[model samples]
Target: MGTLVSLGSFCLVRFAVRLLLLMFRGAEASTFTFVNKCGQTVWPGILSNAGSPALESTGFELPAASSRAFQPPTGWSGRFWARTGCSAAASGGAWSCATGDCGSGQVECNGAGAAPPATLAEFTLAPSSAGQDFYDVSLVDGYNLPMVVEASGTPGAGGSCAATGCVVDLNRMCPAELRVAEGGACRSACEAFGTPEFCCSGAYASPATCRPSTYSQMFKSACPKSYSYAFDDPTSTFTCAGGADYTITFCPGSAPSQKSSRDSSTSSTTTASSTYSGTGGGLTLEDDSWLASLATGDASHATTARGPVPFLYSFIAAMALAYTLLQ
Candidate 1:
């Protein structure tokens, strides 16, 4: 049974990655710098698209007021989100996070994606066909921390570039029903309700049907440039003019002179309880060597899958497929 599950995962992931590449062709090579400016430490998780190769390290520790830089090969499309209140895994040297846990029970998520109700910074760089990079800070999954993506430097030739993200901390204003992780993160209405209206499933899957709700509007009001809903691409998705490299910062207000209204209000913060915690070092590394083997050519890494995907991706993918077909 485990073998069958792994086989299915391999096929599904491979198909998904291929479709992503075709959808975002002309992607260019780029380097990303993930910086942690939050007052507390966070474990950052990385997950590439199904067919895409994995990054150098799937997960790692980023202490408060620190940063790390890594390069994703051309055509890579995936997400980066922080996990807070992590404790080291008992046997694997892995860290389990209170929020944004990837279910790998390790620092490296391997090929696994993040759990929902976590702020996500997503990227699709250098889409060859469009000749641009598309990126956005998404609150559609919900919010845990403040974040922003800045693209500096000139665009190549005729390309254009700009910065876009939700620099405001939404947790302070998150609706009571949508609050999760003891208010450390905000859960999207869809995640909380799981109905057709909130999840945009079944009949509500189409863009025309799944219009923005009052809750999404609240998020938009707080961060106009960020994605408040799944179909907010027209307003939320930003192009980097010429596929420029980017700096993704947690707590954008931590930067000089960027303090937002949310940052200034009261300013008292609380730490949530975590099931696990771990410092950096002495952890078992998941076997991600398959990434390099598959990177050499256009081939799928068809090994036995390790675990079922975290529920977040499965839900999002289903909704996305419904939206596409209904549209």
Candidate 2:
């Protein structure tokens, strides 16, 4: 009887160990690291899909040259954007941002999403380790800043697993008609004209009908890898292997040495010299070795972003339960 009881206790402990491994594995599947390389502060806002659970923070302040990390569970889907020029209303009034405001009146966006004219990083993580994750940097709503999304993991079969983003500073060259004078954001043609064609609404909802407008063409010319219009899935969407972590960098790389231009009358293209004078002096768009270093676990920032406390606690608890059962 004693021997039988010992065997049963051992089996229970083994089962508990397996269960804890599965739980932690799911927790570590997706770690989002947001790096703010901009010269000014960036308040990043997150909005989870209807069926997804909220992360530890819906929004938070990320100062320049800093980064923050979050681990979302499997099957999570959400969109992320940065708010600029934020401040509190005098005398204990509502806090607000000049661009990409979630209108939650505070840093924590809660369930709110960013207002228009904000560059967005959208993601839908795989449900399991075997599935693929779909992600993209979208300017369909317009652009406020330069942003990039880089995935790090084992490449899945039939997946591109490439980095995609708008690294150029679009605000400097945005069409005068679409430029937001106060906040330096660039509005989409839909927001500027409010026409059904530009908005991809009414009769132009389908991909076949909603062709890219001249404005979207200009955006596409500048940021080819980004979503320039409503139906830009072909080039804008990117996929990675399951269990990959992503790093979203704002104001990535040095200022552009050249900018893209289009003449409406002649439909001609011209390139102009431009540069981004952000504070990220050591990083440049051309040199992506730093990103590769991150993937190989050579970057110091990558190690600091993930903590082992949760796993440690879980192991302790499981061992304690096993000990009690054995006794």
Candidate 3:
């Protein structure tokens, strides 16, 4: 988990912070700057490794001049969106925004059978800072996920570090690695950003491959000898670049909380609730929920999951073979 400092729309956040500090001494005071990417804030709360807390959304409104987005607590996993100053009702859990991409005016978190929110690249956010009263969020999601671009002309070089499918690190951006290479997404930017006629199939990789609404973004300038690949933000971490002259880093609009053992545990152990809403617009959490309040992590972290996948595969294969020969 990372820290989400100031989100967009900071019209009244500075004032709110002043008021919050006056009340709760040492309260982290993480605020939601994004008012409405698409939906209104229904249930606002500050997410944390310990747990999310419903904020007093009596009067929280964001400024109309920010580009930061919302952020989940250190332990929670979700997406946040916003720009500049945010306006929200801390006590009332309401938000004021003209338009946002929060999904047809509905924003929620933590639930089963619930579709994962749109993927955000460079899930950017400004950590609580002095300059801005609210958080600032920016990310790289060509498709519902963050992205790093790489080019062939400068693989592992400047700008090329993030050409087409670069890996977005928590604190830094790097070349996105490929499980399978040599086509589609090149390991270099020179190859990725060249004319489409140079690519393997005369097509440049784009996120729109997944969503039609984003189809226009599919076409690239054209690559010399490069290809593009999409990486899943939740799991993938390494990236490769085709060229190596520059490293292009996509600055996020906001940042997540610092990663920690406890928070990692929560991500895996905690079950998705039936419903969970956000503030600013006062989203209602789901009732009849079954999500467990637990920590998550690798086996070494006390979280229990299936044992080593390789060992399981071997055993299953052996059993299958034995049964087959016997029959």
The candidate that wins on TM-score is 2
Worst 10 residues of 3 by lDDT: 288-297
What tens digits encode model 2's per-residue C-alpha lDDT throughout 1-327?
989987898799888889788766854477787877777788999999999999999999987766777878888999999999899988888999988999999999999998889999999999886899999999988998888777765557866666677876778778889988363789999989999999999999999899999999988887877899999998788787777778777877532111110011122111222234532222333455533333232323221122233456777788788788778
Ranking by lDDT: 2, 1, 3
lDDT (10s digit) by residue, model 3, range 1-327 = 122323322424444445445433222222223222222222221222223332222122322222122323322222232211134445765433222222222232222111111122222212222211111111222222222221112112211112222122111111343101111111222233333322212343443332211211121211111112231122222222211111111221121122221222233122112111121111121220110100111212111121122234544555565445434
**Comparing 1 and 3 on lDDT, the stronger one:** 1
Each model's lDDT comes to: 0.65, 0.75, 0.23
Indicate the worst ten consecutive residues by lDDT in candidate 1. 275-284
Clash pairs, model 2 backbone: 255-276
lDDT string for model 1 (1-327, tens) is: 989867776666666667665434323345576666666788888888877788899998887666677767766788999888899767777668888899897788887878888888888866442466777789889887766665543444543344566655567677789988887788998998888887788999899999899999898877776788878887667665433456676664322222221222222222222211122111111233322221121113311111232334655676486455433
Cα-based lDDT at residue 280, candidate 2: 20
Q: In model 1, state the lDDT of residue 41.
A: 87
Stretches of candidate 1 exceeding 4 Å from the true structure:
1-28, 89-94, 127-130, 153-160, 241-243, 254-327
Q: Of 2 and 3, which scores higher on lDDT?
A: 2
TM-score of 3: 0.21
Each model's total of backbone clashes: 18, 1, 155
Of the pair 1 and 2, which is ahead by lDDT? 2
Error of 1 at 321 (Å): 56
Compared with the true structure, the alpha-carbon lDDT of candidate 2 equals 0.75
